[model samples]
Target: MIISRESGFRHDTKRRGQSMPKRHPVNQTHNALEDEDSCAVYTALLADQGSTRSELRTKARLPLPVFTAAMEQLHRLGLVERDPSADERLLALPPATAMIRTCGDDLRYLAEKQERVYRVTASLSPYSRVYREMPSSGGITASGKRLLNRAEVGETLRDLTAGARGEILTSLPTGESEELFTLTENALRRGVRLRALYRSSVQFNQSSARDTQRLIRLGAEVRLVEDGFTEIVVIDRSAAVLPLRDDAEGALVVQDPHVVHFIVNAYSRAWAEGSAFPVRYRRQQVLEASDRTKHVIMKLLAEGAEVPTIAKRLAISPRTCQRHISEIMNRLGARNRFHAGYLVGQRGLVD
Candidate 1:
């Protein structure tokens, strides 16, 4: 039996009638300069620099086929050269020199590839501009407003937030989704200033409280308001998104500079009237926890909100809400609920 070292193969040399050890096929596929066969041949040649090809195969202990393949690959890599003075002898180049030559070739190839990429992109620039200027099927209106269905709002908001370089102002009455929470986190990481406004009653929602706290920790400014406010998102004061209908079935994306500026002004006014959200954290907390529920109740009462409505908004029982209302009425020395609310505003309590 003949055994090949690097290839890990055993060749049986027995006749048909004789019992012999297991035989395996020889490996002939690998011929790269880095393979074990090439490495063995190179090392042998290094030890005896001016050796002939036949002497290298004998010293390397590699089969003739493997030795020939390894030598061809080494020559291609400039690691082996013909010794002109010696008849059939081979000369081994310094490994460092060969590596530098190979790397220079690879770098030149990569530079050419990168240049081709730039040229291809430049050729397509005009088509990209044309695509952006073309109108969508039914999403864009004549007024330059794009209509987005409920399913498209999240995608559009993601794109807008990703591209936003300046401040992002948002007023959402129904609270934000977890997907939006993640998207906003990414925006905040990019150093974009964010100011979000939500209904004061959202403080009672455990989910919203957790998400809002995380956002605050990431340098977002949040506020709570009790009075009327519209749901909108103003990005960079250049674009605005609003509900297309009262039911929130769709959205209207406005990019008209004048319309966007108007929305921005309205948002600014509402934001000024809002109260800072009480973040439960260390020194980074925005506001100290106060009787915010009572304050909100006062505002709702002034707005003529009923007992059940106030209770639902505050996430409390109606009986508990009535008790608070009674306390307020007694403290004001008022005759009726409406009269108590009148005194609350008359005394400038909600301010």
Candidate 2:
């Protein structure tokens, strides 16, 4: 006979003529194996087949209290059972049988819970219908807001971008999405001014970089921020859509004028601070710092600043500073940093 517990209910599966069902060993470890003392008790009982609790405890060399606890654990795990014939005698189930019984119990419990959930859901479905059909004042809902699922969010974004007239401001994370690229492209084609912020990490992703390059080529202004804010889209400074929560696949669309204005202002600040996307220069084009960066580097070099000092002053890496120094030397036909500084001073580049 085998015993199992499902949702605190016991089930008995009896077999004909209990010849101590063939003990089939299982190579896989069970949760019951985690307890050393319980494992010791189970091992001893498995070897001896049928032994009184006290006899097995003595054979296992465990104290009474410890053995009792181990036996309790074994019982809970369905590995050991009290003999129906004798009060103190016990029987050890085959490892495979115990595993099967335990798994069946868990499956039964889950089935019961799933049935209950289905019942509850069915009972509330009418209420869900009523809520969906509930009337609104002036056909208006809660503060010009809509909660949209993943698919709906994409469709709604496409609609918003297609209808946009003035401008679109968007913040993107570290991955590329075909939906975003398509919508952004459509908006730009309508002569809608679009400023997009992408996480700096996105530049490292080949596909996302390609998407960004396509957008830039289509006249969409793109910038990279150290940490991109949550994925958002603001259309014509009148509406904003963002994720409802980090873990949720739904989005929240907000159209309240005040709220939209706040989101647009916040986006403006981030855009102002974000760095322009790096230009992919052609082979013949020279790589040099921007005019402002070049002017600062020139001033620093004239001050006899080291590479590290120049880098810190310009918020760049020493390697980049050194590269700029080399470019400046080549540009001025100079041989070294000292000569570069002399050329800059003579050309009044810093002034």
Candidate 3:
């Protein structure tokens, strides 16, 4: 087995009977030098479009053997192209294409893929050994917080959830969580307790509402709360993830016992206050904001309030209140205020 330099995670280097070379494998592990060297080669390719072995070696300031190995690794990873008909020069893939195709839509899997690539080479470079020898910093500091930028969040968060053995809790935002659905599903399949909290608005969104309903059917306990929440992901009470702020461009990871407990407590309180995400919360379950306002007005009309009084109660202009009344009547196909009141009763919008 070869231990990953990033987090000391071990993956079997042996596959189908392959073995690590008898050389100083640690010294040959992939690290900073290879990264710098690859960048130099890529930059050169940008200029000439297709770089010869000699050209790349010169540009990267690497010897023949080192250049050869680096190019081989890059080629394997689909970062560069070598066409037989186009000679032996290296052609870099377009940046967007290379990134999306190689890393997919998320940056989480890059580390595992790199580990597999290095394992195939079977010998670590001196640069890699030096990186391994360096003391760890930033992750799990003495303060028990690990700070990561937006670029690092996906991978680190994925790693945290993947290690869950008992439970996973997530408070999702308004946006889609397509990437996390599979991860959560996997945890459930492993008999891990899965619970998720979402904004009440999500049940009104067709796509996400479907996703939550699907999750519920699959044994995930999904609930909804309305507003005043931040994104938090907790794994078995051992770790908690919080985005740095609303923008989600960075995150603060909490592994300290006190901090993790604090986050879990908040989650528990929210969970207690939330409503179950009804699989019955299908299409059009929630009315539009304006529509809900109309219903509110209907109740006021039902109670025999005049337009001026309704407008004051709702904090809208009387003209706006009259407009909403017209809209509500139009929607309910009512003849007048009395008929609209009758429709509201029929629809059961309010007691």
RMSD of each: 23.6, 16.9, 22.1
Clashes of 1: 0
The local distance difference test score of model 1 is 0.78
lDDT of 3 by residue, 1-351 (tens): 777899899877576775543431122367897877777777777777777777777777877877877776676456788755678866788867765665563454445567878886666676555553443654444544545465577787678778899999898855237777877877778888888887665665688877777777778998776542568888999988787644456677777889889888888999998777766633455454455567668888888788887765554568878898998889889999778888788788776
Question: Candidate 1: worst 10 consecutive residues by lDDT?
Answer: 281-290
Per-candidate clash tally? 0, 0, 7
CA lDDT, every model vs. true structure: 0.78, 0.74, 0.72
Name the candidate, 2 or 3, with the larger TM-score value. Answer: 3
lDDT of 1 at 202: 67
Per-model TM against the reference: 0.48, 0.42, 0.43
Winning candidate number (lDDT): 1
Best by TM-score: 1
Q: What stretches of model 1 exceed 4 Å from their correct place?
A: 1-148, 281-296, 299-303, 307-351
What's model 1's TM-score?
A: 0.48
Q: Write model 2 residue lDDT over 152-188, tens digit each, in one string.
A: 7788888898899999888876544788888888888
The collision pairs in model 2 are: none
- Candidate 1 lDDT by residue in tens digits, 1-351: 878898879855464554432322324465454488888999999999999998999999988887888887787667898899987999889878876665665556557667978999999999777654564654576455555456678778888899999999888864567777788889999999999988776665678888888899999999887643778888898888888764466677888999898888888899898887766545423232225567778888888889998876765669867887887788889888899889898999986
Q: Which stretches of candidate 2 lie over 4 Å from their true place?
A: 1-144, 281-351
Q: What is the lDDT of residue 181 in candidate 3?
A: 85
